[model samples]
Target chain A: MFTRNPAGLAALLTFVLSAAMVFAQAPNLGKPVSPAEIAAWDINVLPDGSGLPPGSGTPADGARIYTAKCSACHGPEGKGGPSARLVGGEPVKNMSSEKTIAGFWPYSTTLFDYIRRAMPWQQPRSLTNEEVYALTAYILSQNQLIGERDAMNAQTLPKVRMPNRDGFIVRFPDRTP
Target chain B: MNKTPSDRIKRELTDLQAVAGNGLLHRRALLRGGAALAGAMTGYTLLPSALGQQLTDDAWSRVPGSTVPDYGSRSRFEKDVVRTLSNPKGEPRTQHARTPHHLINGTFTPNGLHFVISHAGDPDIEPDKHRLVIHGLVKQPLVFTLDTLARYPMVSRMAFVECGGNSAPLFSPQPIQASVQALHGLVSCSEWTGVPLSTLLDEAGIDPKAKWLIAEGGDSPHLSRSVPLSKAMDDAMIALYQNGERIMPGNGYPMRLLLPGWEGNMNTKWVRRIQLTEGPGMTFYESRTYAAILPGGKAYQFYFMQEVKSFITHPSPGLAMKGPGFYEISGIAYSGYGRIAKVMVSADGGKSWAQAALQEPVHSKAFTRFRAPWRWDGGPAVLQSRAWDEAGYAQPTRTQLVAARGETAQVPPVTAFPSQHYNAIVSWSVERGGEVKHVYA
Candidate 1:
């Protein structure tokens, strides 16, 4: 066939070469992320405890960890310190005021997620899962939201109700006076 | 002082000649001014050297300057600094830097002067290693690199991003004496260019049951927010460029989630991952920090759309009136829902109002400049502006907002009312001596 039509053979060869070049240039725009890679970065915990890692911690253990790691910035008892206050302040009444994890935070899971992802002010994402759970328990117990001896695991953390859980009302598209 | 345009130009030229004769224009000064003029001519000028140098010497000299061009830095002379509010003893990473709105003019905010509200500080990432993974509840989970995403079809848009607590300080009983930018600088408008998120989501083939997509950043906090899929498919974009240039490091270099008209925090910067889900992730920012307490002791959550709001930039706190005679009252009005219909200017407090002229091409979810002609008799007066959107939503007064949202005691002193969205009418009191100040009417 090539011998019969030399021009056609030349055009065919050019087309094939260009196609090969295009494929070769961009071998893979980006490699497919493996499930293991996703798991390493997918550390988000939902309100229903979807991303909670396997860990257990008591409020007593949390108190000790809080003193060692968090107290420098978040105050001695997580009340009115250089960093954001974690424990004190009243719940949402008729008047708007400062928000605390126990009084304002709707999900207990958020405490764990926030502390695990960003805490200690200077060093972030450095706490172990057990340390995060213990810190959450200590902050909650200090606010009188959880029992002092209650061990916060994946199951109990989600079950722990927050004061402002039902306080939030969806008023997005229709926010009239 | 009542000179026409041509007369003003001639007078300015005479003044320049007089200054030159007085030998005030030194060779170094002339060189600097000439460079500034050349920069202005080429449209590469960041700020006028006269203003930039003064401001730099005053406060910003201590901060570092950008050496690399790709990273993008501001002019040293630019006086519009981000007023940072943070604990002096704690790490400065977790702080809010307010944009100087009063110092800026027109609709589009300069990238360098844009406000920043950092929850866990800015992160440094390598673009070559940066990857955006789209998984969860999809037929084909895909991972895209910066170059790959850039290869897709691109779209450009102009929108605004406002922090949920932009005007929380206005809730104070006594009017806060601050520049408009210092008080409301958390909000900023920019022209963003990138590929539509819907195009990527379509390629991934989203599942019918997926309701929310969690957008996570690569920063230390890994800042994440659950954005509704409807919005994602409607107008959301993974922005790669800002104001016709590559995104800056401070403003989410490489990639950012540009959610038009949504709360600023929802537009995650340095975006790295997006996971489709059936419900909101209920992250710390969404469930707690951004929520506002209402009158009935209930908190308002997911209050995404910024309501109608407007404020007079000229004759504001910083820019005093020079023996007010004939002046054009200028300001900006914007709405998240739709285009601005009208802006009403009130010089006699709330007793009477006059409709101000809206600038042409009032784009939706963007800043619309407005101006009204006024002849002041050099008397004490109160200036205010009220905005109305195409949706018939009128900007509320401070009293009305307080009545609707309720107010707390002045315990924190910084913010008396913690309502995340406070789009109320802002008032500026003018004294007989041509001094202007913020006031609550």
Candidate 2:
């Protein structure tokens, strides 16, 4: 087919040469890692419960942990405090209004994710998977989004619908996933 | 050629002319050299008394200078020029260090004074033990140490990382009385050198299903944000060096993820992992903290771009006009879209504007200094700057911006971020007494 058009043949040769040049430029220095080896550092939990660890807890277990570990900065039962209030929030009337789990959080999985990685500000990443699930259950239950007896696990955490789930509009829709 | 100093000064002063209303001189007047500009500075051309002072050797000129240290430091006289910290006590919360824009000039912010918003205090991470891993949704999960990343082919670029709420105080119904640093200082630029994220991702062999990548930091909070996979392939970098040295601890020592022109929080500091995934993580930072609330109660999520914005730094609040004879109104103009196309200066509110000259080699997404020659008559004047980006977006005026993004019902504290991504025109009113203050004109 190229014999009928010499220009087409030249174009194809140039494209192949440029593609080769591009492939040659990558350094390819990354050492292959195993999934088991990455587990220690892989703490991220997505909204779809992609990385949630296998654990379960109820609001009762979470209340005991919250009083012992979190009440100092977060105030008793996650009311207003020196830090941020985590429980009930007045509806977000304006931009300045306080954002709480019930008022503004979009996904319940984010609560589990944040608590697992950053809660109890001074001692971060100290909570076990079960403790994180319990805290998530307690916060959700306090916000009246979940029942007091509902045990939160990897399966149930992502299923809890947040009050402000549909409140957000992606500013740049075209640029997102 | 034999003219006296007075004759030359008078001639130069006479040559200067106003280009716009309220004594805005020709932009090229700055190019006329220091002697001419100096004469213009003093309302009168003749500085006979100053010129008559005897030229005696000063104490510093007579004695040898102090010994130099191994690491350089700015002059002690410049000690006052430093970042203002929001949490000096290092409390258990996010701390903000704002750059002093009025005190400094030029495009690149010094490494020591770069604005930092540390969720927890800066972590003291030892470079030797630090590891960077790329996993999830890739053909092969990969790991790289700091030393290995340093060996790769690296590129350098000047980029500005601006917080989504940099100038949030401007969202107040009434302009808050504050310095330019207090109002607009969260954004800063520096030359960042790093290996392209695409090169590393290419080595990992991306799966076709991967659409987003979650970048996490090694800081105590383990702060993380999900970035579009397309951006990672475009211009993202695993930046190792900032301003020709190892990155500062506050700015993410060892390494940080540099997403040029994106929200500041998304550029995770002390970045340790990049996990490619099928969708956004919808992490705490994105799902709540950075999401901006709009009028009618709905919020705007993923507002990534720091849009076209500019503010007069020299004559802004706290920098008095100094009897303003011929003052050059200058400040920073930048846009995430591209290079700044044009900047217009208005001495009398936004009624009439004179085009300001943009500094040469204006890099995309970096601070471009815009200067306008002004011959202020020392009367009441509301000074403002409006910038336009190459992408055809103009910085909206105060009235226009407030109409679109509602202002606070009550004035917010200067430190409060009521809303995010505020990129409107900033106005500074100059009084007859030469005192400049924040204004809503």
What TM-score results for chain B in every one of the models?
Answer: 0.81, 0.96
- The alpha-carbon deviation from the true structure for residue A103 of candidate 1, after best TM-score superposition, in angstroms, is 1.6
Listed per candidate, the RMSD to the true structure in angstroms reads: 10.9, 2.9
lDDT of 2 at A16: 100
Clashing pairs in 1: B52-B77, B52-B78, B53-B77, B101-B181
Give me the candidate number with maximum DockQ.
2
The runs of at least 3 residues in candidate 1 whose Cα sits more than 4 Å from the true structure, single-residue gaps closed, are A1-31, A94-96, B1-93, B411-419
lDDT of 2 at A175: 33
Error of 2 at B193 (Å): 0.4
> Which number leads on TM-score?
2
TM-score of candidate 2 on Cα atoms, chains taken together: 0.95
* Candidates 1 onward: DockQ, in order: 0.36, 0.59
Model 1 agreement with the true structure over A1-177: per-residue lDDT tens digits: 899999999999999999987743422344456667788777788889998999999999999999998888788878856677888787767545567776678889988888887776678778888999998889888988888999999999999988878888887656574
